[model samples]
Target: MALSEIPMGQIRTYGQIGKAISCQSAQAVGTAVSKNPWLILIPCHRVLPSSGHLGNYAVGEDVKCFLLRLEGLRFDNP
Candidate 1:
């Protein structure tokens, strides 16, 4: 699956995943990610804002940052 393709310690943007899934809008991808019912299985936490802002996660931006940081992925800003 597309989510599984994301490397363990890397980050990806919603727009990138959208393109992979043949969708044109990153917002659409974000919507799909927000609705991902699989939670940890889908690894939706790896998806971020195209501007590298981290955006609003389904849970919260803090949780998203924590998970990414736990994976050793660094971000300049949320």
Candidate 2:
């Protein structure tokens, strides 16, 4: 999965993942990501919206923010 391909400390937008898999809908990608059962194993926390906002996760947004921050990613607007 493209989610697995996202390097640690890096992030990808939903549209980017969709494009990587040849899917045109970012919402579809978001849906697929939300359904990920592997959680951190797949690094779904690394996926965000095109607006650079932290989108929904199977886990809470706080946990997602925590994971991303732990990975050395900082957010000016977070």
Question: Which segments of model 2 are wrong by more than 4 Å?
Answer: 76-78
User: How well is each residue in 1-78 modelled by candidate 2, as lDDT tens digits?
Assistant: 799999999999999999999999999999988889999788999989988778787778888889988999885434
lDDT of 2: 0.88
TM-score of 1: 0.86
Candidate 2 TM-score versus the reference:
0.93
TM-score of each: 0.86, 0.93
| RMSD of every prediction | 1.5, 1.2
Cα lDDT tens digits, model 1, 1-78, are 688799888878988898898989988888878888876777888888888687877787788788888889876563
RMSD of 1: 1.5
Off by over 4 Å in 1: 76-78
lDDT of 1 at 56: 76
lDDT of each: 0.82, 0.88
